[model samples]
Target: MPHAYQPPQRRSRLTRRGRLLLLFTALLGLGLGATVLLPLLSPGEAPEKPRQLLIPEGWRAAQVYAAIDKE
Candidate 1:
């Protein structure tokens, strides 16, 4: 008698635990890449200082125009 042939069982889809583990691994990889790679890629220029402007609180449009005209 010939032995009966049987098909292999299909693999199951990822479970909740497997999905969470994949997500954690992806985030850890991205974090490591940023920490190790960013400084090496950045140029050595000193960071530009931001310009400061002082606008008085509650100043109306007319007041701003008058101030500009006085200059």
Candidate 2:
């Protein structure tokens, strides 16, 4: 009987742990991307402009505090 020549079989590079790690990394990336993009994509209220206070010159500190409190 003559022996037959057979080619060696190749194995996968990623093991079970590697596959799980890759999946976890992909999921984490997707979660981070969604977190960053969701606020930008959704329709939301525009930010209100800051209110400016016009204080006359020579106003006392107490007057300024009272005006701020009133507003």
Candidate 3:
């Protein structure tokens, strides 16, 4: 009697768990890279402007000093 021939098996395929782990690792790496690079790529914040006080015209020196101190 003649025996049937069997083909050689391949071993490079990943299991379901392995594929999920690989996907999770890739996503984690991408998130980490973005977290590290986003700050460096973004423009700096604008500087704050100095506070200003508008005093009425003809104000006395003492009044002006008081207004400045009050603010």
Q: For model 2, how does the per-residue alpha-carbon lDDT over 1-71 read when each residue is reduced to its tens digit? A: 59888788897699899999999999999999999999999999989999989889999999999999988
Q: How accurate is candidate 2 locally (lDDT)?
A: 0.95
Please report how far candidate 1 places residue 64 from its true position, in Å: 60
TM per candidate: 0.49, 0.78, 0.49
Which residue pairs overlap in candidate 2's backbone? none
Candidate 1 lDDT over 27-62, as tens digits, reads 999999999899989887898898655669999989
lDDT, each prediction: 0.88, 0.95, 0.95
Native-to-model Cα distance after best TM-score fit, residue 70 in candidate 2, in Å: 1.5
Better of 2 and 3 by TM-score: 2
lDDT of 1 at 8: 90
lDDT by residue for model 3 (20-64), tens: 999999999999999999998999798788999999999999999
In terms of TM-score, which candidate is strongest? 2
